[model samples]
Target: MGKYIVIQGQNIYDVALHIYGAVEGVTDLLVNNESVSFDTDLKAGDELIYSDDYQINKEVTAYYKMHGITPASGEQHVYPKVFSLPKTVEIYTSAKEVGVEFSVSGNGKIELDWGDNSEVQTITLSDKITVFSHLFDSTIGNKRHVSMYMQGHINQLDISGLRPIELYILKSIPIERFVLNNATLSIDSLPMLETAFGVSLDGLKTNDLTPLLELKNLMSLSLTQTIYRQPTIDAYLIGLVRQHDNRRNCKVVMTARPSGEYREPTRDSNSHYRITSGMEAVWVLTHEPAWNEGGIWEFIINETTYKYEQNH
Candidate 1:
């Protein structure tokens, strides 16, 4: 004969008393998905189905473990989640060092891991919110990983007073990837030997990409859903290619739309196309703005050259 525990169709009260050592309310725990109380009883081979809440708890635990992050007191921020910014403000996560700024005031969050066992801080300001800043003073060469969440909104951002190499030093890494969605970016830097690369503006009306001159490590740039007229596109693309050729030997990829339903590619599309010493090659793609179907432009860089003509 096998030992069997019986539920007997009693409410949680009766079952808890019999199976657990004088412990009642075990059934309520099962229904509510609370941690099993110490007194709850169960006989051999007794089984209880898990409630929905149990699954949610398990997922949350898994997320924390994978991302190595936790929530702060009085705040609701989770790791591996994207954040956006509301306004432009200077921050000093590291003393006396300038940080990036956003043009439009809106909600933006950052994936942050402060040095010296500091908990990750995630913040999202409202539309009226502006000037998102942080402080960092990790020992020089101590690298940290920070990410921004832009999601699907169209906005503009700029990183001022930092060269491409300085950026790498700040992050403690060489290869950096930035994501932009329906947004425009303006980087301000003087001519330097180092190279940097990132996505171009989707709807940029500006003629010069001189703001991006010092980014020698630039590899991929996406320009999917911008509202540039044909002439603006031609001028911008030509000028960009020329600039890259003149500075660091880096290859650049320009993307655009050919028709409402067709996509195309343009490589070294400048009038006086000259390959840079570091540039392996240049590629341009013309496609419908992904935003048309609710998608942002994607810039996938396989090179990091910034070649543009002095006059486009």
Candidate 2:
């Protein structure tokens, strides 16, 4: 990333919108400069390193060292900027045939390896998602590990009807937005390591969302219209996140409901912190009425308090 010297008084969100033309860019800023939080004030002349298309200038690296600021390693991004670098998702399916596809902006390309030793499918990406469906070849084993690589800087990746038993996204660069639908995958099987910034899950398997607490890099999550046919929310995940070190802002969207009547698990439960469900958390119960007609509930969690704003 290149360097930026703030010439005006601003905050993290302002700077992110200014630099990347999108407020969501704040995730990269936080990842790069851990010393700076979402609430950090950016005054004029404050030097900061950010993700960019340009190479890191050696002098900028030296300046960071002299200033005792260590840029956190790993993908750290934006344009309102396209995401370059290749982002990959591997799907392991028991289905007789495997099908998956996505689209990317710019002149980016997509490659799909059937893993059946057949010819790889490559396409120049377009506005519409390029789809690939392949029948399992018995000689190569019907069960396959199909892989898709997205090249270039596309913000969102959406794949539906991929009933993968196991799915994982491994990337050289972070894909800020992702959507998974019609899959048997569970959050527990995901690596969850800094791969995504915002994820929307719908029509997926696993109502047990306890594994969501393990997420490390996320600004937004959507569970609405998901596996939970019951108007239930996983308050346990929220309680644990509140207990953990995530004071920074995270937006969670789910169906309208309290945590439901199940025994909630927590660190205090002495179960090694494995997530449990039960009890209507204060926040959920308070906002339960907003989504009575099937709307979106956005949960905002900050340092001390948590709340939700609903759109009907």
Candidate 3:
């Protein structure tokens, strides 16, 4: 059994829908708490008991899967395991200057270990985006391996700025969202990856997407300013979600904003990607025409508002 505390303006039906994905679970809620009936008023902080074996409607799960959004009741969040470190990231680069910028949805701590025998730098993060950078010696010709260890639940990691190096991360962290630009990082690097945004897929032949076809848990992938050699948009988007004989649902975002005079994607500044998977993917490419409205779009998911604005 599980307990749900009532909040302001909540009633038995709200609890039923929240737990079971449908209001029909009201019967089960009423039966479990005989002391409380439909006639009884639900007050703030009132504890209500519910069965653990309750089944969420299949449609709810399908809808979530189509968009790569995981609910609280999903199996991935339920599994438990032991790990030496709860979260870790490894970066393989030869760039003299190495740095990474990312943010967390809540409170957390992230530490970086530069392989060149530098002091381990620590970053304390809040809802505000945090950045950490370290300069490496360009004199060294060999590639250096940098590592990141994290504590607490941080939601998003953006690897922008200078990339084009190998990225290796542990499977324990379960980071569901990522932002990549000019990066040679393998898609298979993160084990629990469910949603990702390929920041810039500009070049066609240069983007070796062989590793992309081998994904497992990916639910959404939006490649901005994309230029692929695929026969058609339909085949390319569907190929992302299909794994040979096994097929799955994945929501993809496509927009057709004209390139700049230099043929680069129009970007007045550092634009934003969907920071969290729970944030709805508004104006998704579902059927027919391949592009969506190219401008600022607003989306509200899970009571949070996120805007995907482009300066076309």
Model with the higher lDDT, candidate 1 or 3: 3
Determine which window of 10 residues in candidate 3 has minimal summed lDDT.
Answer: 73-82
Ranking by lDDT: 2, 3, 1
In the predicted model 3, the residue pairs found to clash are: none
**Predicted candidate 1 versus true structure: per-residue lDDT over 138-246, tens digit per residue:** 2222223343323222222333222112222222112233332343333232122133244444434333455454564555555545444545444444444444433
lDDT of 2 at 119: 53
Error of 1 at 306 (Å): 18
Each prediction's number of clashing residue pairs: 58, 4, 0
Question: What is candidate 3's CA lDDT for residue 96?
Answer: 52
Candidate 2 backbone collisions, by pair: 78-81, 83-153, 264-277, 265-276
lDDT of each: 0.34, 0.53, 0.48
Q: Identify the superior model by TM-score, candidate 1 or candidate 2.
A: 2
Q: Model 1 off-target regions past 4 Å?
A: 1-175, 184-208, 244-312
List where candidate 2 sits over 4 angstroms from the true fold. 1-88, 98-110, 123-141, 149-152, 170-173, 189-195, 214-217, 228-236, 243-248, 260-312
Question: Residue 95 in candidate 3 has what lDDT?
Answer: 38
- For model 2 the local lDDT of residue 197 reads 65
